[model samples]
Target: MKAMSKWNKSVALLTALILVLGVFAAGCGGNEESDAIKIGVNYELSGNVATYGTSCKNGIMLAFEEINKNDGVLGKQIEGVVQDNKSQNREARNVAEKLVSEGVVAVIGPATTGNVQAEEPVLTKAKIPLLATAATAPEVTYDEKTKKVRDYVFRVCIIDPDQSQVMANYIFDELKLKTGSILVDKGNDYSVGLGKTFKEYFTAKGGKIVAEEGFVDTDTAFKPQLTSISSKKPDFIYIPAYYNQVGLIIKQARELGVNLPIMGADGWDSPKLVDLATADSLNKCYFTNHYSVEDPAERIQNFVKAYQEKYDSTPDAFAALGYDAGYLMAEAIKQAGSPDPEKIQQAIADIKGFEGVTGKLSYDEKHNPIKEVSIIEMANGKQKLIKKMLPEH
Candidate 1:
């Protein structure tokens, strides 16, 4: 009886030990999954700029798929935690905080300048590297007031000042247009910044700003502003606003008999713009963009082909920039050989000559991409490449 009791006790102890070990192993497995290298995507997926956010998300996912197929970076599978910011600044800040708390090593986007700016402080405070895909504002990465680049911030797209100068130079030198008028959305940081830069560059190049007018984003009736600007009879009208407002402004301007050539910034590069404005109204319009689908370069063609095959749609500038941003982050992670945020930040700063779908990108001291801007023209509701301008810097 004593021997039998001892045997039973031993059996019970062994079973309990085995159960404890099993529970521990399961916990470790869960930890591994929780510790996977994660990249956060904070984007405006369901708001005013939903198209841009969706395109960027699709491109980033495509890149993530490819990276995982190759065993991901640093032997850990990369995962993305995507959150919609709803195109609101307050929501963007909250999204940023939520992503950091969830242990993301890096963040990819909040496609618009305003959203990016809104989330900048949160990510910077957390020391997480943010690679802006489509936010072109110079201040996205640089502080003009402090004359310093935010260490944790970087962008894959050219800044607004560079884009504005490119457009201004094209109008002043290539088209030889002397007098121009500006229509700006005062409520939008992107519109206001680009409009100011274009005005500065254009006037410095001996071009005259015959008239300047401003409107809020909610104001759909641009006819009054267009009529006022039309009375100036400028050679071209520069509308530095998003496609949502720019499309209406263009259509209304054409309706008001202000048929002069319309020029805009990268904000106008959306398929929805075509839906908003007629082809005849958009005929003589041009805008500065990151990549032109009409580019015949082998790299560009390959990217476009792969994107089309995967997404079953044409990739726009935002998509290309998002892809580039993903690849850039992967490269930084690989170079760092660890998912540590500081190491990834250093690796990104040291990146040079990184070939991206948009262009060959390298970050300058200010964390802005050193890339060329493509001038795209609207021809029969399609964006056609007209010229590529390299920054003088």
Candidate 2:
């Protein structure tokens, strides 16, 4: 009886030991964490700027799909935890908090400067890196007043000054358009800042700003400003605003018989630009962009082909930058040799010559991509790559 009782106790002990070991194994695995690395994709997915967000999301999805189909980073798949900012500041902050809660290693996008800035406090406090895909404002990665780089912030696009100054260089030195007019949106920092930079650079290069007109973002009627600009007879008009208003402005300017080359920044890269302005009206329109589908380089062409095959549309500068953001994160993860966020952040800061569809770039001290700008000219609804120029400085 005593021997039989001892055997029963031993069996119960063995069973309990196995159950505890199984629980430990499951805890260590933790489902998705063991199988994939998570990166947050917070962007303006469904809002006034839906075009930019959708394009960016499409590009990010393509990059991760390609990475996973082959060999994923560190033998684990990358999962993008996408959240829409809805083109609102409050929504952006909410998305940032949600991404942090999801335990993402890094976050990408909030494409515009204001939305990007809105999430800064949340992400910075959470110790998660925020990489803006298309936020071109100078303050996105650094504080203007403090004049210091934000430790947890980075970007894959050039800031406003770079694109603005580069376009100014092309206008004054290359295109030889010695006089320019500025039509700026008073409410938008991006538009207003671009005008300031372009004016500064162009005037410094011996060009004159013959007329400057201001309009609020909501104004659809731009004839008054257009008329004022036309009266000055400037060589070109720079409408430093987004596609929504810029499109109407272009159409109105054309109808008003203001026939001159109109220029803008990356905000003009949306497909809807042609639709809003009409193809014919955009003939002499140009904008400084991150990438042009018209680029003939093998790398650029290959990306364009793949994107077209997948999305059934031409990839814009936003898409290119988002695609680069995905690969940039992957590269940093690989270089860090660990999924630890701190190591990954350091690796990203040290990156140089990182190949992107837009341009081969390295992170500058300020974490902006050091890359050339592609000047895109619109002709009858078709985009043509006129020239690629490096920043003057």
Candidate 3:
């Protein structure tokens, strides 16, 4: 009887061991079947534009979560590895090289055009396709005069000429500003591109550029530029740079007794703009953006809800652009049916009207997206929706 009882105990122990091993094998199978694809993201996560960078990172991560939850793209789980560009061009190059070294199939980011330009050669050499979410400089995908395509580089945002023309038309036809002064950031592709395009279209519409003064992005005090602009006594001041400098310039201009309306491009979409430039200083300010929350698009509403749930705040244009770019690349990859960079690039080149949170995107021959641009006006420290400019395609 003692031997029989001992045998029964041994049998039970064997059964338990087999059950544990079976469970372990099952878990391994689950993970193995869910193999992931790595997509790299480079952004200005910690610098002067940290707010925008953080927002973009959040959006991209949120999209990855959703995609993974849905079994990811093309039977593969989506993994995103993000790097901060530190809002510097050289850092952008480093980040791009690191991402390429990591075996990422395609990359999205380094938001500004300057950063994009700095990383372009590396990405081009690596043969990795880069889809910039918010780099609107005309040189993003081509040399404007030559109309030559920069094959490895593409943009999910509208290019500068489209945005610049829209803003010019809005000011001239909508606001009826026949004369204005351009306070541009010297040698900034973003500023120079927008300024040149606006000047051309504004002048073509019989408008006059009364005063033009160049300021560097790092310049803290703009009182002198404001004083110089004040001498021209133009109807408005157009600043084409990021909000960090734009806000300060506007505040200093106001403090220096320059009470003209301030206008800008999409770079002015930061909530910090309102926070930094106080109500009294930022009165009569307007700028262009990718989308307006108040515009009532279901995609925008969904994205905002998801973002609020995750991060407890609304998403800005940069965030929306990042999300769209990530999803767009995933879609292109699935369409290509392989991780080959050439195939993915070809697929992206043929991307059609994809309804994104930012806007409806369909690339033109120049690799520029044709979409609607939002004109937002700041009144009482809030972004008041003014108008939507549709693409003239």
RMSD of each: 9.7, 10.5, 10.6
| Candidates 2 and 3, the one with greater lDDT | 2
TM-score of each: 0.84, 0.86, 0.81
User: How many collisions per candidate?
Assistant: 0, 0, 0
| C-alpha lDDT of all candidate models, in order | 0.90, 0.88, 0.85
Per-residue lDDT of candidate 3, residues 293-356 (tens digit): 7777777888888888998888888888888887898889999998788889999999998888
Ranking by lDDT: 1, 2, 3
- Cα shift from native, residue 308, model 1 (Å): 2.9
Candidate 2 local lDDT, 1-393, one digit each (tens): 999999999999999999899668645655736578989999898989887888888888889988989889999989888888999999999999988886889998888888989999998898888888888878788787999999889998888899888899988888889989999999988889999999998899899999998999778899988998999899999987989899999999899998899999888877889889999999988899888888889988988999999999988888888898888989999999988888888999999999888888888888887888989899889989998888854
Which residue runs does candidate 2 get wrong by more than 4 Å? 1-33
lDDT-wise, the better of 1 and 3 is 1
Q: What value of lDDT does candidate 3 attain over all alpha carbons?
A: 0.85
Model 3, 309: alpha-carbon shift in Å? 1.5
Which 10 consecutive residues of model 3 have the lowest summed lDDT?
26-35
lDDT per residue as tens, model 1, 216-235: 98898998888889888899
- C-alpha RMSD of candidate 2: 10.5
Ranked by TM-score, the better of candidates 2 and 3 is 2
Candidate 1 TM-score versus the reference: 0.84
